[model samples]
Target chain A: MTEVTLSNVVKRYGKQQAVHGIDLDIQDGEFLVLVGPSGCGKSTTLRMIAGLEDISDGEISIGNRVVNDLPPRERNISMVFQNYALYPHMTVRENLGFTLQIAKQPEAQITRAVNEAAGILGLDELMDRKPAELSGGQRQRVAMGRAIVRQPDVFLFDEPLSNLDAKLRTQMRVEIKKLHQRVGNTIIYVTHDQVEAMTLADRIVLMRDGHIVQVGTPLELFNTPVNTFAATFIGSPPMNLADGVVSDAGTIVLRDSLTIPVPKSARAHVKPGQKVQLGFRADNLMPVGHAVEEKGELVDLELTVALTEPLGTETLLFADLAGLEVQAKMLNPRPVQPGEKLAFHLMLDKTHVFDAASGVALRG
Target chain B: MRRRIPEWFVLLLPAFIVIAAVVLIPLIFSLYSSFTPYKLTRPSTLWRWIGTANYEKILTDVKFWSAFGRTILFLTIALNVELLLGLLIALMVNKVTWGQRTLRTILMFPMMFSPILVGFQFKFIFNDNIGLVNNALQSLGVSNAALPWLVDGNLAMFSIIFAEVWMSTSVFAILILAGLFAIPQDPLEAAKVDGCTPWQTFRHITLPFLMPFIFIAMTIRSLDVARAYDIVQIMTGGGPAGRTELLWTLMSRTGYVDARMGLANAMGYVSILLSIAFTVYFFKKLSAARAELGMGG
Candidate 1:
């Protein structure tokens, strides 16, 4: 296993900078997930590491050796593409043993290595079958088998599970994690799904518009986001953002023109009459009747429930709060009807405050 | 019982009738003529049946047998040389980064020219006296004596084979280039990552994938080459004592010039066998190559 480090790595296509100067140090055997929206250069960054793209500036070191000028094969890295580019002409056995055969390994050794890899991937029965004879999930396994048989220092997976069905994707995701654990190799995976990023990554590097917005552990990013982008991006149902200002009555006035007491910890970060944004996770909002009204920053607002989702374990209420839509997860099932008003308590201690103009999270 | 004709048969009826009139009837008429002493000018001779006479004569004729042997040799040599040159040109063109489209269009220009024109061009270039080739040699003083480019048996055969190859090699090149274009980019990338050399990648990956296309071009050109007529006719008319006489040229003299339609029909039926054999061989190879690649059974 190898540690990968990118120091001021810049990639530009003509005058358009696809990857702004970025630095990241991935520890040995760390499963780093680079999460971003489209056009965020996540794939480009992965390709550069794979030597599929040229680095415009700066250097990349793998296992403490600068590999800026080396080709992909010389870098001793194996990449699994999103499309599972298995050689269509060869059988699964040949596809797995192809690298060893090229390296001039013995015929017996090639057969042994391929058989072991096929056994691990559960492709023993399909060793002789061609890629066209297999199903999509089988092809994905064959792609993984091709990579694992090489035993490279690092494994690069570029959205490998994106082509699978939803159930198969969940299954393959666990298989990939197990594969990483068994092999104990450093893996750098690129994906757009935050759940995949948060679940699979030992450390998630959140990117936007070709720049790393923040890099931290899953819980660190979830609990303390550096900006509004990182805060809304890493969670499902997303963080609810409401516009407000610090009032002269020693409270925060929301956009609906209702005022609630500001948390004491946030007083140093805000001043009276200053515009601010209030952010809180969906799970932090408690249904009015179930919550103790006097214990936290309780606000009584008319919420028109737009939809209700009963997820078996809990229910989600999609409602318009003070003319702005937000989601609140409720543990106790309620007869929350659509297009009807409801009351909720917002836990001010669990809430986040951000600078209105700069979108930076205010320190508490 | 009352019967209702299907609407699908009505739609297919026009094509079936046309195919019968254009192809099937002619084929049957020719098959019948092969067993008869029929001539184009002598209509009543169609009723005169001669059992195995024409076939026996053709089978025993040394000149006809030699022409058949020579035709096969010419086909084998010309097709192989054309395939090699076409593959080389395709590889070189595929390597070209700049002006590739222009090079492809230029390469296809030879195919656009009729074979008859190419025959005339090469015939003049290889003519002995008062020709460009002889004139150039004499002017350069490389040879005091003029070489016979079309008179000698071997020279005439070589001249005709050269013309045939030049006019058709691009046919293979263009078709094989289409195959090269359809090959996915992934395999080559994977091969590169697998640490394969350029030659290894082409031999193990690219060429096998291209075999089906190569065989298809071969089958089509084999039929076209077996019926090669216009160029040979325009160049030498199978003349100079029948030194370069292929089947089509020999058959033409037997039917139209010598007024022996029955014998020509016999030759025609024999040549069709050759065409069917080559087509079957190439088709079998194509299927095997596809199966090897795991494309389909």
Candidate 2:
């Protein structure tokens, strides 16, 4: 029942605006992640919901209660900050029990709640030690235990895993996902890493500047990005895009040399002689004989390999198509030297077309 | 071997001579004088070694003991009140978003005044006649009588303690303010999200973090307040019947006005013990506070 909703939420600092009016609806028990580059207002949005930052001109409600003027404690929400923010002077037991203690619960009740959280987070042996005595990962677990002891309706995480190393971050990501599954509480997490957003989010809210670019599940945003920004921002090496023009014969003119039939999904959205950009990920474009058969119409091209990155099982081949650099994947990786010619197949079904001038997706 | 001076002692000779001349000699001289029946007016009495006589007399004197007790009481009350007031001021100033620097500078104004000047300022303000406190009270119709602020035993003591606090509270404030600034904002924010009320946050997160700073201020001010002489002397000169007399005033009066250098030196030695005790006690508390903050003391 702890569904969080933000309608036209805006944040302004004096003369400048940090977050424009944005609408969001977070479902109960759903793990939603707000993600973007630095200064994209994703953190600001989360803080506003957590009641740490004030919303300049919008209504925010938790469980049907308009909490615009209510204090954080009254909102029944717990937050884990980027830095663990453990009480340095207190032991892990005290840190975990603090919220309940503050609520004036009986000492016995607080101890019970603390012990439960400790057991859940595997903090039993470390209970007597202060935050300074704990390692980064241990401190992070204490912070989560502190947040859980309150048993709040919703949990808010602001780049909580950003401080950990790459290996630790991956480990904590699994811990967080497992924690969410066990707790079944509505969680709103924020991070700048797209991999985190893709892996952990039931829904990802991609933000840029002060606006939300798009909101969808990981597969939806990956398979169908709204525009060039989404296409380029989601995948690791980024989706390869080439500038081209629409032809009168249901084909695309690329660099004035090669002509490929337009992707069927975008045929209705483009008119003859219109400017457009062709977008496809490395996964969709594969070298022949190394790739499985794609049911979608495949356009074959013999492109010169510029470079190849061998990633253990698969090799990423960088090839030139009409003087434009594009990435293609080779599943059954074999060493290919630079300037070596290789035949590649572009899966038209997965390929996306965009209005070049507007950078808007042409798919219906 | 005895005929030859060791190279290590030779290397240290210059430093030893300098320290002995500057610091050790004066300390030894004072200790010697405290044991002798020395009088400043008669240099001939300097050689008279009357061991334990001065200490025995001063220890038995009712006035000396009273002044010693008064100094301790003054230190206790003034230090505690100043600590509490300074913490309040620092917390309030930390909340100011803009013009905080300007406010902090202004907060230090009281500390800039010399203790003597502060004593005079408060003496006049608390005067029964032609003073600010009395005048304001009379005009406001709060009282019709001119209360003897510097004559009554309790009021005179209050006036001097008030003066000391006015001149020194800013030390506590500035230190605590620095503590406030140094405290990471993360814990405070965490406290807020953890359902702590403002008071609870301050009592738990803010105050515990400020403990080391508070103890540091106490350690410094304990030494400063123990030797409170200038302000007490200027305002009361150890009386209106010796009501506001303290250890410093009693010692200075015995040595200078009464010319009993030996007895005064004996009193000074005793008071030095008090200062040392306070310092050691505060240092212990400071280290304990640092330990609680998980900083290895």
Candidate 3:
């Protein structure tokens, strides 16, 4: 196992730069995931680490050795592509043994390694079948098995579970986590799915337009995003944002007469008549019956219920808060009809306030 | 109720009649005449049933057997050489990033020329004294003696093989290039990540994927080369004491110039066996390669 460091890494295709100079230090045996939307250069960064794509500028070191000039084989890295790129002509046994054969290992050793990988992946019975004969999940396992048998210093996964169905993707995510724990190799996985990043990464690097917006644990990003993009991008159902202006009394004034007092934590960042964006997650806005007395500010608002989505244990309520559509969660919710006004309390401690023009967060 | 003829059969009757007149009748007539000593000059000789006399003579003829062996040698050399050269050209062309379309179009130039025209072109280039090769060699101080390219047995065979390969190697290159394009990029990357060198990746991944395409090109070129008529006829005409006589050249002289149609018909039937054997062999190899790639059987 080895640590991978990218110092000012940048990638360019012709004149258009896909990845700006971004620095990341991945610890040995750490599962770091690079997550972003499409065109966010997350996959490009992974490919650069794999040596599949050349870096336009800066140095990439694996195990503290500069590998910019080395080919992929010399770098001692194994990559699992988004599409499970198993050799179509080879059976699972051969696919797992390919790297060992190329390295000229002994026949007995190669067989032992292949068998061990097969056992790890529960692929012993399917070892004789070609990739085309395997199901999608089986192919994914074989792809991972091929990487596992190599015993490389670093394992690179380029959205390896994207092609599987939703249920299978979740299953494979667990398997990947278990494999990482068992093998303890440094892994850099790239995915557009936030849930995958949240579930699988030890530290998640969120990027936008080739720039890293945040680098933190999943809860850190969920609790405190540095900007509006991270706040919404990391959470499912996204953070609800509304335009507001700071009143002369250090309160946020919404559409007409609606107002909320700024939390003491962000009071210093606001000024009179300063335009700002108010952000809060759906779960923080509790309905009246479920509201609890918390240490932070609790402001009650009479919101007209626009819609409700029952999700077994709780219901997601879409309501209009002072002319702004906002989503709130109701625990122990009874059936509430549309156009009904309900009192909902805003958990100001959990709410985020951003500069309207710059989208920068105001909380400490 | 009266039974009615199928409308599809009625619609196809014209094609059937045309095929019978143009294809079926000639095939049957040739099979029938192969048993007779039918001479073009003596029409009545067509009725004389020889009953495998021509076949027996051809089976025993040293000249005919030599031509048959030479034809096989020529086909084997041309197909293998063309495939190798075509693979080289295709690999080089596939690497070109800029002006690839123009290069692809230029690669087809040799195939556009007629075989007979190519024959004349090589014939003059290999002429004993005044040829371009001889003049260039002498002027460059490489040799003082005139090289008899069309006279010596080996040189004559080499010249013919060169012309054939030059004209047809592009067929393999074009088809294999198409196969190269059809290959997905993921497997190649996977091979690289699996620690394969460039050459190993090519041997293990790229070439296996192109095997079916290469065999297809070989099947087509083999049939075309086994007939080996126009180029040899124009370049050497089975001359220099029959040193480079292919089966088609020998059979043509026997049939048309010698007017012994019965003997020529026998030779034609025997040569057809070569084409069928090559076609079957290539097809089997193609299917095996496809199966190894996990395609349909």
lDDT (Cα atoms) of all candidates against the true structure: 0.87, 0.92, 0.93
Worst 10 residues of 3 chain B by lDDT: B126-135
User: Which 10-residue window in model 3 chain A sums to the lowest lDDT?
Assistant: A288-297
Q: What is the C-alpha RMSD of each candidate to the true structure, in Å?
A: 3.0, 2.5, 1.7
For A261-294, candidate 3 gives per-residue lDDT tens digits of 8877789998999899999999889897864444
Q: Which RMSD does model 1 reach against the true structure?
A: 3.0
In terms of lDDT, which candidate is stronger, 1 or 3? 3
Instruction: Tell me which residue pairs clash in candidate 3.
Output: none
- What is the full ranking by TM-score, best candidate first? 3, 2, 1
Residue A184 C-alpha lDDT in model 1: 89
Model 1, TM vs. native: 0.92
lDDT of 3 by residue, B43-154 (tens): 8989999899999998999999999999999999999999999999999999999999999999999999989999999999999877899999999999999999999989
Per-residue accuracy of model 1 over A166-206 as CA lDDT, tens digit each: 99999899999999899989999999989899889999999
Candidate 2 residue lDDT tens string, B29-107 = 9999999888999988889999999999988999999999999999999999999999988988998999999999999
lDDT by residue for model 1 over B1-297, one digit each (tens)?
Answer: 979899999999999999999999999998898999889889888889997788998889887888788888888999999999999999889889899999999998888998889989988988997668788998999987877888888888888888888888988899889989988877776776676778878987899889888988999998999888988898888877988888999999999998889889998988788889888988898888888877674
**Candidate 1 chain A lowest-lDDT run of ten:** A290-299
Top candidate by TM-score: 3
A1-364, model 2: which lDDT tens digit per residue? 9889999999999978999999999999999999999999999999998888988999999999999999888999999999999999999999999898888899999999999999988999999998889999999999999999989999999999989999999999999999999999999999999999999999999999999999999999999999999999998879999998999999999994699899999998999999999999998889988886666799999999999999978899999989899998899798899999998899999999988998999988
True contacts kept of 3: 0.77
Query: Under CAPRI classification, how is model 1 graded?
Result: medium
